[model samples]
Target: MVDLTALLADLAAESAQLDALVVALPPDAWRRPTPAPGWTIAHQIAHLAWTDHVARLAATDPAAFYGSVIAAPDPARLVDDGAAEFLAPSARLLARWRSGRTALAEALAAVPPGEKLPWYGTRMSATSMATARIMETWAHGEDVAEALGVTRTPTARLRHVAHLGFRTLGHGFAAHGRAAPTAPVRVTLTAPDGSTWAFGPADAADQVAGPALDFCLLVTQRRHRADLALVATGPTADEWLDVAQAFAGPPGAGRKPGAGRRAGARA
Candidate 1:
């Protein structure tokens, strides 16, 4: 079973760390373009804040949450607001983002474990809510780090993201008008802290293994699986890499070798 408390705690901690990172950036730097095409640092943080607010609303009241979804404006509006606020000398935008995250964490803390909450058409337990938050923060954080030309150490929280990615692979393939592979694929992730995470049956016909950071980057589509030392032992393993996805809504355009090259590597 998922540990709701531990997951929530990790979400809060990671959110706080991300908040600090944004707060420390110079005003000009916040408007600088991020690795996510057309998104600035401010835009990324704003999306985080907005999503947290949406999640909080979803958790507390299901019907009201779905009601608001219909009226929600394009996320670009939030990004515009973020860019404007970031240009100001004060840190109001950062503070607002932090406040939203705090409220989100508090709401999760008060919820009873295993309680089902409405999210879009389905209901999710408090544990799933926390897990989703961690996955988003880590994914977006990678965008910020990439824009800034920095590297971030992987945390245990990444295991949750990896698990979700593995679970979603079949859906990813189907969305692209392709059939799921006939053979099962194994995944082994070695995290920075020396902890390991694995998915799939031990006797699966194919395998992929590497550092957790590399796995997360590949599955998130931030980096290509081939760019890292990810080992794939069979045809199924290679096929799975072509369609890995971490998000639920839709399969993003999968990364190819050109887009997958590591920063500064020759084209």
Candidate 2:
């Protein structure tokens, strides 16, 4: 299993960094286009802030959380409210994001080490929740960073993201109306700090290997794996490449070249 404490600390630090990045933006930049379709920088930050709030609620009341709140009313209306609520004012958005993040971190720290909290469809431990949050933040941050023409270094915490990607491969393939690939693929990621992470069978004939940042980019569909220095050794590895996903909900349609280059480059 992954280290829960370290994962939470990394997530909290990343959230703080993102908070700083958002606040550093000029007022006009908040309305600037982001990589996410139809979302501005304001929209992206709003989603993050709202997700943090949702996490807190899930931590507090796992059993009733999804039913009473997440599944209530029109989903689009909820999303719109979440986006509009945080985007009310640039300064207030930044303040609320920072303050809410602090509270969320505190709540995470208060949970018992092995207790499982209710999430989208399964019960997740505090550690898993922290890791999931980090993955989501990093993925969305990629959108913002691309819009700003900035590059972020991949961290050891990305192992969590990669693991999530591994777990969701079947879902991605199923969404495309295709059966899951038959063969296993090995993934090896080298962190910016020089730590190495691996997933899947140790002796798998097929493989994907690269820096953790690139792996995250590919899995999140923010960048094509072919554009990076990733190595795919077998048919299964190649197939996995076409269907990798790191986020929840429906599978993303993935990106095509030249769609939005001025926004940012893939890490």
Model 1, position 115: C-alpha lDDT score: 83
Question: What ranges in model 2 sit over 4 Å off?
Answer: 68-71, 76-81, 258-267
Task: Give the C-alpha lDDT of model 1.
Answer: 0.72
RMSD of each: 4.2, 3.0
C-alpha RMSD in Å of predicted model 1 compared with the true structure: 4.2
Instruction: Give the poorly placed runs of model 1, Cα more than 4 Å off.
Output: 73-90, 120-122, 180-182, 254-267
- Model 2 per-residue lDDT tens digits across residues 69-115: 65657653565566666675788887888777778888888898788
TM-score of each: 0.85, 0.86
The global C-alpha lDDT for each of the candidates, from Candidate 1 onward, is: 0.72, 0.75
